[model samples]
Target: MSDKKFELSRRNALIGLGTVGLASAGAGVGTSAYFSDEESFEDNTLTAGELDLFVDYWTGANSEAIDGGTTGSGQNDGGVSAQYVLNDVKPGDSGKLVFCPKIVDNPAWLWAGSSGFTQYENDLTEPEAEVDDTGGDPGAGNGELADNIQVTVAYCEPSDDLEGSDPSGPEDFETVRELNNPEDYTLTDLLLELQYGYLLDGYVEEGGEWVPTDDGAYPASPDSDTQTGPCICIEWNVPTTVGNVIQSDSVEFDLGFYAEQERHNENPTSPYATGTTDDLYPPFDSNRALGMSIQGSGGSGSAEAEIHNATSGNTAFPFGNANDDSDNFPADQDVDFTATLDVDSNTASLEVLGSQAGGTDVTASDTDVTDGQGDGNALGSDTEWQNGGIPQTVDVAISARSLNSDTTTVKNLTLNGTSVSPDQLAASAGPEQTYLVLQGIDSSAGNTIEIDGTLNIEGDASGWSGIDGLVINWR
Candidate 1:
């Protein structure tokens, strides 16, 4: 045999010799590096790490207000507020709230004639007045202003640790989130999971007739027909743990209105018009627009604590958009919304980066002999090893086949596997298919691999021993 001795570093020797009988060497290894044999090594090592969950803003529901001042032709600027009781949130955790508004109806007028016939009016002026002023019956005129409907959402999470006693008091109001400007906000990833609907409501008349009323109640006639409002539903994501709670967020909706008279100018002599008079009647057409707002808050609550169980594998919760019946709003009038939490830890995927020779095979090893077989062929097999311990080191021969097409340019290589170190790996420019030397084996008393530096593999066209016994772990 050639007198040339393989220069094995202290790290590699310890790692190679440490494979005495450990059975936890399969936790971080990948299937690609499995042994030539079909049998697999069963590993049972547990690792400790932190996880993060994300939440986003979304729209809820919308309803129309038919009350006196809340109807068509009238300006409605009313809102409702309620307190949400979180059962398990802890101090320091953060949360957010979002709100959205939708137009449930358009502004219009309905007229009842003396002949007991109903007529629909598009103008803000009376038909008889239009005829008297123009010498011929004219169509209704447009109203002074369009629909002026506005909606706002405000949230707070106060703490008793502060200078106040009442959590809901103004002094205690923390102002966690707000949705006053829908034009400036963007929706988060969680909010894009569901669909939303738009709606409009207004008044309509049957016929064009006018009757003098003894009482001067602005036309004095009741509407011939009343239009109902539409409904919308929203969906979003939420979290069940302390870390995720800080990422909880929300969305708000806002419906906009435009002046009907402005739009009517395009149709100066619309079919609905009777003559060329400015006397328009009630029931003018008001254009509706939909608006949206997204916001978030940061605070702790009882709800966070109840959901995050250290011992339990599950840590996710869900919430529905149904309103409390005691709130006095009709069930149909409430917005329909849904919230979900993504707590499955397995959903997270890992990636490793490094370069390997085409003919080289990465092997797996066990530190404890009692936990693993003696032969070095335990690539896919399980071996006993400590958590975060070094299980194996790779030794390969650099050759022409392993080099890139240029043969001189060092190619950035990537090794994909779990618990891999150097997290990233690379190879330098040299010859083709030559035995390249790779050293360093994590032999810390524990089975975990402590990788801190890079390993170089170099050779000529003749090629060298690609790699000998390599070790890895899988979970």
Candidate 2:
């Protein structure tokens, strides 16, 4: 028979932080594809292709851990079980299926340390305290009195097809899906969508009693006629190894007193109550029905080509329909395909190239410097200096201002041992006498000129002194 195609959606999309690679095209990886044709998928219905089944387990509000126990405290710890049956297809042809449970609205309240009774009493009014000891307080030297409970479902591939014969024993026929740690699994809000069915009604066995009322609570007697519903109870120890599937045996939960008390409070006139007297009220009952269905799509036109893990080659694997049906298969159709890791030399080189572009490098530097000064003599004017024997010349200007008086003038100015007056200068100045040294002047033009490295000026009549100067070189 021709292979079929399919597309699977994630059930708990936001719960985990891991990436699930698609099987390769010869082996699909990192992609979700669908089939385009409908005819091919229908034609391959009877073909021996793989089948994928997803099973979900659901629990009612009362099924969660009540007060401090693993089951409810008030009513019988009765729960319901449900089964979702699907067509048996081949192993590889089926699409991915995910099962999730509904989130509990009213979680079980926990009582810490040895104060279970004290905590319970604190939560209730005086009249409600009458039934406090029905379940035996955890502090009363009785073992921990747990009022909370939980229901879970396990999934396994059946040894024998629903209709086929099996030589394997019952043990061999069942594959156990262990659910030892309820805390590790994802709890969803989807369980509310399931259709409930009854498996065990309100039946609390001996020594399996719980408090049933806030006032004068007592051990719950088995009631075949009690309003019952279905619930799936998972065993704490489920097998991890895969094999054939088996039907689970009836399990027990401690339906503590609160469930029955709440139920009684809801319907004071319930038939299960002892008297019609309004003040003499009975405890409440819990709803236990549970069911769920997960739908998906498939077809041959939608078959995904993936890389094979062992052969390292591309191959087609059947992913179910867009709408999760096993009957439809479209032939010779265009389907999406993805490639898996084929780390050849070229691929490795590309990866290395990508890394190189994002890297950085650091290094050191090189250069030089020179310093020289000539004719160390004190000068009262700005002057120019030049390298010996160089035709290039440098110019300098100097001036002094009077602080006490508004008028100021230059006293003496010199450059390279040559005396020069402010009047001999060419540059313009303010009210003060300033000297401007012309660099291109005769023999002095090529002479190196220097000062005490400082020019200090004192004003005469004004008794004020201010110095301002500028030096310049020209090549």
TM-scores for every candidate against the unseen true structure: 0.14, 0.14
User: Candidate 2, after superposition: displacement of residue 351 in Å?
Assistant: 51
Residue lDDT tens for model 2, 246-365: 111011111111121222243221121111133222221112100000001101222121111001112122334223333111221222111111111101000001112221111100
What global local distance difference test value does model 1 have?
A: 0.19
Best-fitting candidate, measured by lDDT? Answer: 2
lDDT score for residue 48 of model 1 = 31
- Give the alpha carbon lDDT tens digit for every residue of 1-475 in model 1: 0111111111100100000010000011223322333465545344432111111112122111111111011112221122122222222322222221112222212111010011112222343233223221112111100001112224333333665442222233333334232211112211110111111112122342222222211121122122121111111122222121111111121222111221124311111211113222111111111000000010111001011111111111111111211211111111111111111211111111121211111111222333232222221112222233323432211111222122221122222223322232232322122212223333324233222222232332221111110111121
Task: Quote the positional error of residue 343 for candidate 2 in Å.
Answer: 64
Alpha-carbon shift of residue 443 in model 1 (angstroms) = 73
RMSD in Å for all candidates: 36.4, 42.3
> Lowest summed lDDT over 10 consecutive residues: which window, candidate 2?
289-298
